[model samples]
Structure formats: C-alpha cells, structure tokens
Target: MFAVLELGGPNLYDYYVNQEIYSSENKYEIVANIARAAAIALNELHQRAVIHLDIKAENFVIALQENQIDLKVDPFSFKLIDFNTSVLGTDHVKANTASITKIIKAPEIRKKSKNYVNQKVDVWAFGIMIYGLLYSKLNEFNELNVNVMSDKSRYSRLDSELNYYRSNPSNTNLDIIINVFTIKKF
Candidate 1:
C-alpha cells in the first residue's frame, strides 16, 4: 500500500545556506539526526548483506516541526533502489563502476569494483555525508580534507577516496591526494 508522507522543507543538500546565514544549534541537531538515521539504516542493511551505494543529504527529508527531520524511505525501503551499482555479495563479486552515481562513490567501490564491492562501500558514503555536515567548520578547526570535495565533481574527494581505500587498502592511502587524478578506479 502507498502511504503518503510530507515534510516542512527541502533537504539541506537541496537548499543552499549562504555563508552570511548563521547556522543554529538546531541545524546541527538536524544534520546530526540525518546522519544518525543514515548510519543506523546503513548498519541494518549491512546486517542483511545489503549496501547503500548512495548516501547523501539529498536522500533525507526534514519533518515539519519546530526542529524536525523525517527521512524518506521510499524507492529504497520497500524495494532496493540503485541496484544498477549495488553488489549482492552472494558470490564475492565486485560491482561495475557503471552502476552508481560516480560522485558519491566510495573508493572501495572504485578499487575492488572490477565486478563488485561490499558493505564497506556504504561506510565510505557515510563518511562523505559527515564531511559535508562538518565542512563549514573547517575554517575554524583548521581542518582540511585530503582530496577536498571535487571542484569539478560534487562529492567530497577525500570521502570518496577514503571509502575506496577502506574497501581496498594499499600503500597509497596517504598519497590519494595526488593519486585520485592519476587513477581510473577512484
């Protein structure tokens, strides 16, 4: 059965917050809530041998409360979504690079993805989402991403690369900054 749902506003990824706009404490809560839900959901899916290749703020929806977030679970909840890039892990197979949104892609996906990858790929995507959540504080914390979100691409470079390495570790982990451009998988 189709159950109708609604939200007060668009996702944080959909709405651009200007630097002039000051982020409130609730905003932090909202982002944290979204991240938490994603993490929990990912963990559940992994337990069932499923991996969400795509994890981003755009995938979430905020509930219409004074400070609420209601994450949507359609398209992917009832049935697995984005199977084009998803790996079944039934035969230790790797996923094809063509099956995913090249941007949010985890490096693990890129590395071992001659045919398939595993749950760790989802973790990489989660890390990227967290990066976006805390990106604004980089200036204050003197923080910098290894690859930085793509200037040419949308997803965070470091997150994508790290995700790949976690799934497919190599000596080049620290050198990903320079290797990303030269490599094909990542």
Candidate 2:
C-alpha cells in the first residue's frame, strides 16, 4: 500500500550545500538540533522494532514554513523520510548491502556477513551522518585518506578518527552530539 505525503523543503544535503542558507550565526546549534532530530527519529523507529536500512542526509528534509524554507533549527522541524528499505524486526537480518551506501555502511554490512544486520546498523549510519553534518561534506569511502586503501582499512581508520573526536570534545553542541553518537549503542 502507498500513502501520500506532503512535499517537504529541501533535504539536509541540499540545504547544507547552499552556503547562503547555511550561513547562520548559530550554525553549530542548528546542526546539533538536526542531529538530535535524526537521532530521536531513529530512536523512535528502533523502539517500534523498525530499522531504517538507509539513513543519510538526503533522507531528511527541512520542514517548510508557509511555503518558505525554515532555517530556525527546531528539533522537530526536520523529518526523516525514505523508508522503502526499512525492516520491521529486531533481529539480525540478511545483509542487503546494495541499498546501503558504502560511506555509511556498518562494518558488518561492509563485510557482507549473513544475518549481520541489526538496529546497530542504524546507529552506525547515524554516527556517520553526524560526522558528515559536522564536517559539512559527506566524504566518499575512498576520500577518507590520500592513499588508497581497502574498504575495511578505511573504515578502521574512520572509526579511530571518530573515537578520537569523541574523546576530545570541544564543548560545542555539535561535539556533544558527536560524542553521543559515537558512544551510543543501539
């Protein structure tokens, strides 16, 4: 069955890429709010035994206000969409790596292990999403370092960087969000 939904404003990726719209004085706060919103959404879904297999910036849209783009950063102003790949269960499921982006794929998914997917996959994607939001660019897997490396090695290095950032919080709102994302399980 299909349900009709309202067309929302530009997605996080598009909104972020537009420098003019993203040049707010409280950029960090805005990003923090967005991150929180996405986390909350994911948490709610997890609570309902749903796993959003595809979690990325493009799947989140900024809520519009009277046909205008809203940049106020209300935690509820952002909406998570694109649930075509979601599954409604709380167990390790078969890997469907084709639907997940390599940049945000969890280690288990990247390894193509059978029945290796669980809610934690969403957590991994959430952390990567926060990282992209904080850095203002969604880095490609190959772009993580100058030298070419296997996906496994690149992911290991990325995980180390995330741990480093988590340990070295700068006291910013975004840093707090990153800390939570990095340490959060399930």
Candidate 3:
C-alpha cells in the first residue's frame, strides 16, 4: 500500500520555514488553515481509535494536486504521515516515550508511566501544536521550564496579556487551556 501511494510535496515544518513554498498566502491565513486541517485530521484519527503518538509539524505532509499550479488553488491539502510509532488501538503502554520529540510530547509520554494512557494525550499535543503555530515558540510552554511553571511568572504574563480585553473572565479560559497542556500524567 505504501508503495502505491503518491509522493507528498513537503512536510509542514519545512513548508512553513521555507518562504518559497508558503510565500503566496497571508501568514495568519496559512496558520489558521493548517490548524483547521490538523484538528480535523486528528479528530478523524481519534474517531477511528488510532493514536498518532508522534504528532509534530514534521510528520504532517502538504499534499498538492496533480497538474495544479502553486497558489492557483488552495495552498495545499494537509496530510498526516509517518505512522511508524503510532498505535492502532487506544491502549496505553508501560514503556518510556522518550523516542518522540521532547517539545510536543504529551504529559503521559513524558512521565514514562506504567499505567494506561488514552486519547487525551493526543488532545494535549494538539493544543501545544496550535500554540506553537500561533506564536512559533515552543520553549515558553515546555513543562521543564521553571520560569513558565512558576506561579509568579505565569500569573504575571497572563495578567498583562489578558489586560487587553475588557472582560476579566476571558482570563479563565486562558488559564484552563494552559493548565490542560501543562498537566502531567501521574
């Protein structure tokens, strides 16, 4: 089956980093499109009971139609590939998940837990990917960083950032989203 598959254009990380490939579209639009595509793809995979344990920008390929001119149509159709580390069933593993990328790895994978982990791990990684796509920075949200995890720093950053909005309640949404990603599986 793999042999019969058509060749993919380029992985998302490479496409985004290379101005030549993604130069035609607006920056914000491109990011938004990629996020939408990724969410839909992940959702479909989860619905099928598959877990893409190694979800990252590099693992997602940009598919272009045959005989289609670049920028003449949509930028490219996003497709998730490289399932060597993926698990077919939603069962958890007792082994260490250090093999995956450190920045985007889920909390359960980080813990190297002996207990069963489910699909929530994918959701966590998806959130991280969205954050990265927006800010293009991964280190700020990494759990290993003491600066981000520190209550003082966390609140200070959130407070100043949230101050732009009139309603203070929106801050809670940010807190929940951040906390959801920061949470580790024990």
Best by TM-score: 2
Clashing pairs in 2: none
Cα lDDT of model 2 by residue, 31-137, tens digit: 77677777777787889988888888888877777766545545446677888778778777665566566667777777663445789888888878877777554
Question: TM per model?
Answer: 0.50, 0.73, 0.63
Note the Cα lDDT for every prediction shown: 0.48, 0.71, 0.60
Predicted model with the maximum lDDT = 2
Model 1, 1-186: lDDT tens digits are: 998854345544544243221275544444444455555556666777765566555554333454545534222121123344555653355556654555557655553346456676677666666555544432321233234444244335454655765677544422432332243565
lDDT tens readout by residue for model 3, 49-119: 88777677777777778865463326446778877666666766433454655555554455553335567
lDDT of 1 at 158: 50
TM-score of 1: 0.50
Assess candidate 3 and give its lDDT.
Answer: 0.60
- Runs in model 3 deviating more than 4 A are 20-25, 69-76, 91-96, 113-115, 138-186
- The ten-residue window of minimal lDDT in model 2 covers 137-146
- Model 2 clashes, total count: 0
Ranking by lDDT, best first? 2, 3, 1
For model 2, what is the alpha-carbon lDDT of residue 182? Answer: 76
List runs of model 2 lying over 4 Å from the truth.
1-5, 19-24, 65-76, 139-150, 173-175, 178-186
